[model samples]
Target chain A: MPVLHPEFWRLLSPEWVLVCFGTLFLLLSALPATRGAKRAIGVMALFGFAVVLVLCAQTLAALSPGMHVAALTGLDGQIGLTVDGFSQVFKFIFVLGALLTVLMSFKYLDVEKAWTGEYFTFLTFAVFGMMVMASGVDLLTLWVGLETMALSVYVLAAYMRRQEPSVEGATKYFLLGAFSSGLYLYGTSLIYGATGTVQLGAIRLALMDRLAHGGPAAVGFPLAAGLVILSVSLLFKAALVPFHWWTPDAYEGAATPITAFMSVAPKAAAFAMLLRIFVVGFLPLAPMWTGLLSLVAVLTMAWGNIAAMLQNNVKRMLAYSSIAHAGYALVGLVAAGRSQSNQGIAAVAFYLLVYAFMNLGAFGLVLYLQREGSAGDQMDDFDGLIQRSPLMAVLMIFFLLSLGGIPPMAGFLGKLMIFYSALDARLYLLVVVLAVTSVISLYYYFRVVYHMFLKEGAPNLPAPSAGRPLGWSLALCGVAVLAIGLYGQPFLHWASQAVLLGR
Target chain B: MTIGWILLSLMIALCALGVVLARSPISSAISLLIGFVGVAILYLALKAEFVAAVQILVYAGGILVLYLFGIMLTDNEALRLTRQTHLQAWPVFVLILVLFLAVGHKLYHSDYTPQQPDSLLMVTDQSQVQALQDRLAQEAAAARHATNPQRVARVLYGDYLYPFEAASVLLLVAVLGAVFLAKKEV
Candidate 1:
């Protein structure tokens, strides 16, 4: 018999916290008690996230010393839960985002009388899966974690099953998600055939070796096909031009809290994986993927901005804007392939962190403006927000400004970093395209600002019925956006450090 | 041995074509099973008996069963074949045909051919064993060498026993999840 080591459990501690919290929440919901039981679960989840935050901090320090710890050494010698700079920064983002989204959900759920323990449990599970994906260095492990998160989100999107849009959104998301996973699996098979290894690190070494010898191995049938398939799968996740059919529907149709979570958490996590795999696993083929990324980035930004201009729905506008932000993030990804990989990656990390807060804050306001029974995301719902509630108007202005990349807001700084990184890579054409697209994007983002601040109050529109507690949550998100924008240097430094760690 | 391998490859290709050309989804799915069987046979011909067995068990049995269940649950509207309403269908088809031609032209010009390894399994004989032992000792001398035939056996036997058992546990979890998800709430 094999003797178990103490460190094995230590390494798996992060995953354990998520599982325990999820199970406990499930049990609490099943038994049920006072109103505070639901509130207590949220508090417990916050506490659990605090613990994970501390654990991740420790791991980050260990990783700073350039530690390379191989997991399951006795068995398969797998690479589990790597703690490089890439993962360290993303783990922070994932945990922080989950905590905030849950807080926002607390207010929204309580008001809707839909506060269920299973909801928090599923959120924890999905967050845990994202963490796993961030650290995954093997193809199979990454795929499994990705599907786990997708499955949970599918159910969460349709949490309000009686609502038609919720059900339709969930079904569409599931069908497309399953199809993407299939493409990913097919890619994995092709990669395995080309390299005879499923481990990312091993595959990199094999591919590097093949390229060194200028022979048949350098370019071949299955290798190109595999790379194309993998790009398609990642494209689906990133919601680039051709693969973005699901984003608007899924975002607009799901519950407000769930939509808020979807807009930030999963998108960031997906980009994290894409960065690792493309920048590390496929580093040898930078010349190939860089050009492809540039083209897609241009198309996505252009199309996403143009599409948002036509949308009358607030949620749909945010959805298209999210796609545009993805294009902006791809600029950083393209720069990662150039001479300054660290700068490009750092830019992406910073952009995602800012995006998580701004998007979530915008959605929080949507939740507040929602009528008692209807989905809280119609454009007309924001009519005369300045008259109905000056505070909400100010918050909405802050969010839209941040999203529009206006100066003195967090979104501006994020855009500054990405555009500068692309220019540093000497990508002249891409820089011009991104700049023009950002101008086009300004039109749509300001449209909401126009409606909220300038338009006259609707005579028939009722005042927002959400109490003081929910208002405070929105206020907090708004303050966070301003603070992060004004005092973003510290965060930017940390993100840059994380990028260096990936190198 | 080459002729046998060629014959098995032909069989697999034929079955794969059958999978694509079959009318009904059920028949197409069944043809895929036949293609999988042919792939397993090819694996055997290549002397990868372990991989061959796994291909049959996992792909042919487990995954195929999942697909069949999925098809069974899908409604007729989703399954129906309807004529295209979009005006761009013809253009899209033409584009695909042109793309196929480009790919076919590239493939026809290329000189690439499959280079089959002599055997997937190393022949076990006294001299062969001695030669393997010598290579193993040399590799053991240098720490850079990853694994040998013997160490793989030891680790799989010793340290991996729990995970092997845990895989079965996972299978159980999957079965329960499938049943629970399919059941209507009381």
Candidate 2:
């Protein structure tokens, strides 16, 4: 007999909504009227996200706080899907980010002549993939979810086929991505060979049993190697250094709003997967993993910051900044591993939530500035933006300052929490690296601001026009950034509640 | 039985070498087909009849043919005229040697060769036969449960229903994306 709680269906309802709409959007895309059908599909996709957001909120409301009890009724043991608070919160973030992506893409799609139903369809599918990644209870589910997300993004990256740069970007992304997935699969197989199980919970129990019997001698060198290899793949997805060669090209080649989507939602998903695998599956082997990851974190921070400083194209610069942010998130994970409680994990979740808003806002502004045919993606494109449209120019400065982690916005709060936790864990070297890179990152983000407010706008930029949709989209991002920055305790409280699911 | 294992392993190694050394794409594909056939034989020797059949049907028959077609159609074939491909050969051989030695060392140290159930059951003692029979029955039951489609479906839908369903959405989006990018003319 099945576990027959009516609320059980609620756990699946968000996914159900995405599937139904994704298929509907797919079929609708097959119709001849591309733009008309695409417009309706975009609105429906937005509605779908709103509905999933509501469902996710309801599910979170129903969960008893601080409980280690089962979240999903039947599926936890059957295939390893967690219906826990952690998954719910990140699903909420994914849905919100998708909604914002659709919102920001309205103008971009029109400008790029890509206002087709398949665009929204791919977005919906990728969002579903991210949701699966966050909630996956087993390695198989996470791997599938990661691939599903990657494959969709590959198509989305090349959505503009006529453009040479776009295709070039997509090709590099697809090739590197395939290679990385192979590494990830190899790591998974190695772990399976060593542990005799694929479920994270089972791996934990197996590792514990070995530890109780003979410690590292039983777990051995190979299992440790497998964990490190698996981490490289996860780190690759999050666009860490050494594995991050694909980020700038992919981000540059994709349409702007899609780039926005790529930067925020997928990175959050990858970080969730990373935190889950480590905190749940490999927590006992912290001694082995902590040192390895801390070293990686330092390299990622240095490369991301140093490379970002050298870039002239705004998109490539943001790509490197995104890599730096991953380094900061890694620092949080390293902290979570050290502290017995869930505070470190909570700090990471909160950081991602804040990162999503600031990064999306910055990218949305990039989209807003884009003119037809030619991408307004260079720093000079932003020269003297304060002269044509003060509201946008000021908002751009706000996003830039926030990204610089100035105390005025959510980005600072996000960085502060992560640093505090690293401090708590006595990760002094990582904290110092985090501090130095952050200071360096400020230089690059402020360069955008300096060009916008301080420098002169290019003479040939089309007169600034703010469509109602674009205005509302920027307003939403701007408000979230400020709200999370000021009176952020409420958001922080909810994020702390999410860390309970780290178990 | 030992002789058969050694002979099959040697055949597989030789076939694999033929695949790597072949000059043209067609010859290389044919050699790969032969290598796959050898692997199927090895699988059959291990008593994995289903895997052996699938290996022959899929790798040797299906994917190898597809590769041949792709090689014939595309310019700048992935396979080259030069044997300078020996660059990859050195690292791959070294890696495989390391892997084989490590696994062989572990197997030898663990006394795995002496533990064959057939050798144990060959004893004439009645108590030993009964114990061996019970153990074999349990192993068979576990294997049967593992191979059964219905049980697999239960595991797929029961535990993995969300990802399973999500994969359908992924494929749908993929279909839509391909059609939009290729079929819809600007």
Candidate 3:
């Protein structure tokens, strides 16, 4: 029988509400009467996100604290989605990222003369797609979710169609993205052929059964090939090294708000999918993948930090920085794989939360600088901002410090947790790589600070006017970075509880 | 039957090569269409009648027409003149060959088989031929009663309902994207 019962719908209410709001945004965008009320539409989108956030939070709260059970939704013998703390935490992160993206886009879009209701529409759908990625337990369901998010972002990346670089970046992103999707589907088919099922739970059971009866040799080569291919696609989406060629160009070419959005939301979603698939589905093959992932983690950190130091453009630098940050999070994953505890997973979750705040805050400052004709993403644009706007420069400093993992900032605590987890797992080499790259990262991050505080401002340029929405977003992010850094125990506890729920 | 399979595979492979090697976009598209038809025939031979029909209807009939129109409308002269380089193709081909060889060696050595009854029965001992025939007869009866479309629909709407619904949303996003990108005005 079909699992279209009331409980299924209730459990899936967040996705339903998101889809409804996304459709409403689409319809409103199409209507000429609503065309002029772009800000109102944006507010409505924010309101929609707020409603879904509340719904997700309520579901999370309703789950008894420390419960290790997942509320799955699907027909008998064919479970596809699981609602649990892990999925909810990631969903909350995606919504928060989208919320901040909308707030940052208000003035940026208006200044660029690129305000369109469809922008919010695509943003809403992208979050919906991400929510699906977080919750989906079936390979096909996750693949569909991945495609939905990718398609929307591809369009959003080229949203400023009039710009040549925007179109060029989106085109390159689309071609590579399509190739990766093909790889994912191929991997999924291979795994299904090997295991006789697409559901993660079923795949695990089948793998366990095979391992028990025939030993390691029974696991088969196809499964190994499938795992490697699947990880390549996920790594590509997360913008890890070797598969991260598109990150710098795409980040630089897309509109600033979108760069911020894609940097946090989609990357977090990709990690969520990675954890779900590898930890839950392929746990039996942990020894194989953990070794593979550690190598990837080390390379991602080395290359990402080294490349960021070479970039003069703030956006591209942040792009490479985001890649390095992904590397740090991968360390958490590798730790999770090595150790017999949930600390590594919790560290990853907490780090992504901290990342979303400081990274968005940094990008928000960049957005604040964007004006009618000036893109304002160059290091020269930030020259002596303290003389003009002390508060903005100070706020930029906090964000930069946090991103560099300096003490007494949320980013520091995030890195510390990952460090502690790696140490716990006895991954000495990964720990060293993480620490050294973080220190190397500080130099590039502080370069912006150097220009902001020490150098002289351009004689012709005026002080950047921060809009109310942008200011609010920056203030929230700044407060989060500081608050989470100072008092991170409760958040860490929450992350650990969420990670345990997956077990 | 094996000879027919080999011949059909050769035809499909040659058409695929034609798609890549042909200079003009029109010929390349035509080659792709022939390739699609060859795959549909292969599907038909596998008794996946619904899949074969849909492959022809969707891929060959609809998408190939769109491709033809796109080729017709765009500047094909520029497409034809642009030299398509295979700078990294040789390395990628070698890597793929290595992978293929590894997989082939594994397949030859291992006793891996799909967890399906028909395939299991096919690989059973000669003494179980009577039981296999009975099982095949029973399966034939069941297949006749359900029909291909009914079985497909049963699984699509029952077991795979979530992904099916999600796929619709995916297609909607694609539509919105196409219109948003291609439209003359916001």
Candidate 4:
């Protein structure tokens, strides 16, 4: 028999809404129409995305109430899709971020005349990949989801082949991404060999038994942990410090909207996998890895923040900031791995939610400040931006400060929660390093403010270009940043109580 | 089955060599398809016929053809495959060699091989066969009411039908996508 639950059907078929709207987009894009129809399609996409967000919120609510929504109701052995509390939270973030990105793409699309059918098709398809990645139950599902997302992003990144930089960035990303995925698969194969299971819950059960009986001397257990960690593919997606060479190029080259989407979505999805693998599967080996990840966390923060301080290009700075944020999230994962409380995991989710808003808002501002000469996305371009468009300048300042973890903004609350969770778990060194790095981040982040309000612009800026679409598209996200920052305790509590939808 | 396995292995090796040695995109694509088919054959040999069929249909028929057609449409000429810079080649090759050696050593030492199943059913020993036959006869007489021989088939087909349907749907979408991508613009 069927699961007999409406919510189960909705959760299992989360991709339905996206696929439907995307097919509509593909068809409409193929047809000849004025720019009005194209813009309407973009609006329709945003509406469809809103539906996804609502569905995700409902799923989160159901999972938080500890409801058992059997994903594979009739399936004997294989697990289907489950929208657990954890997956629900990340899915909410992913869909919400993509919604904002699609909304922001409206202005860029209208401005660049690059609003083709392929653009929306790939974007919708990529968002589908992110949803799948966030909700995946097993290794094979996760791998397929990751590749689906990666292939779409590759095309999106190089969508403008006429632009030399775009082509270069896409080529480098594709080659390196393929290599890293191979390594990730190799690691997954090793873990499968050790555990004989691909499902996260099964892997956790197997690892717990191995650790319990064999203690520290269990060869297969530790090897499994290492392989599973490798299988998370953090180095490629999150751009862990050593594996971050592609970040600067890709971020600098892709269309502004694409860059914004890439920065938040893939990184957030990888963290989902990281949380599952570490907190659930490798909790037994926490002592060995927590210290190691703490060090990675510390170095990632220090290196990323310090590197940001030296970059004049806005995209490159944001790239480094993204790396720092990953470190921040990694700290939460490590604490969650070591602690009995779900606070750390909750903090990571909340941080991701807040990070998406701040990062996307900052990129949106970059899109706003764009002109013929400056084309935005440069520190110099923001010079005296308070004088040109005071509203956008203020918004830009808000985003940059939030990114720097300044108080009274979403980014500060995110950092506070993550650091507090770590401290609660007695991760003293990680907390201390995070504190120091937050201070370091302030220098580079303020440079944006310094350029916007402090420096004088060259007289040749050609006065912010016409036909710029500016309105409440990102206003919701901005309000989100403010509201979540001030009154975050409720979300935190709910996030902690959220359970996996799977059995 | 053994012959099939041997042939599949040979085909895979040949495809790998072709991938390395072929200069043109078409040849390389053909090699990829060949390798994909060989993998499907191996899957069939393992009694995973569904997976084998899907593998051939999806990877070989859909994805490889899409890639080949993409190459054909985008750049008709066979462009020169750029060689790696000589200065960097040695270091890269050495690194790859070291990696291969390390993996080889690990696989060599690891206790990962599955134990062979005992050949009790196939054994030619007269006493063992007679003993087995007597035990089977006694059990058969004791449990003469066995009525559900298709229990496993029922479970697999009836219970896990949705995911099976979903996989089919996913492949259908992929096919449509490849065609959409490969179709020439008017």
User: What C-alpha lDDT values do all the predictions have?
Assistant: 0.73, 0.78, 0.85, 0.72
TM-scores of the first chain across all predictions?
A: 0.93, 0.96, 0.97, 0.93
As for candidate 3, its clashing pairs are none
Model 3: residue A91 alpha-carbon error in angstroms: 0.5
Which structure is stronger by DockQ: 3 or 4? 3
Which tens-of-lDDT digit does each residue in B41-137 have in candidate 2?
8877766677788899899889998998888887644446344745787898999789657643442333111122232121224575466457546
lDDT at B37, model 4: 86
lDDT of 2 at B7: 88
In angstroms, the error of model 3 at A292 is: 1.6
Clashing pairs in 4: A84-A500, A84-A501, A85-A499
Q: Which stretches of candidate 1 lie over 4 Å from their true place?
A: A1-12, A30-39, A67-77, A215-217, A467-472, A500-502, B1-25, B46-51, B54-90, B93-186
lDDT of 1 by residue, B39-106 (tens): 88877776667677889999999999998998788764555464236799799999978965664344
Candidate 4 Cα deviation (angstroms), residue B32 = 5.6
DockQ of each: 0.10, 0.18, 0.24, 0.08
**lDDT (tens digit, per residue) of candidate 3 on A253-338:** 99999999999999999999999888777766666678779989999999999999999999999999999999999999988876
Across residues A1-503, which tens digit of lDDT does each residue of candidate 2 receive? Answer: 23345555666678778877887887887777857667887888888878888987877777776432454521224446677778878888888888888888888877766777878878888888888888786788888889889888888899888878788988998898888888888888888989876778667656766766774567765676677678888988899887899899989988888888898999999988988888877777676677768988999999999999999999999999999998998999999887766778888889888888888888878877788656778998888888878888888877877888898699999999999999999999999999999999988988888898789776766666656666788888899889889889999988886753435
Error of 2 at A421 (Å): 1.2
Candidate with more favorable, higher lDDT: 3 or 4: 3
Q: What is the lDDT for B142 in model 3?
A: 75
Best by DockQ: 3
The reply for model 2, stretches above 4 Å from the true place, is: A1-5, A66-76, A460-462, A500-502, B1-23, B31-48, B76-162, B173-180, B184-186
List per-model TM-scores for chain B.
0.48, 0.51, 0.72, 0.50
Q: Please rank every candidate by lDDT, starting with the best.
A: 3, 2, 1, 4
DockQ of 2: 0.18
DockQ of 4: 0.08
lDDT of 1 by residue, A92-168 (tens): 78877777777677666766677667677778777777776776666766776676667777777877666688778
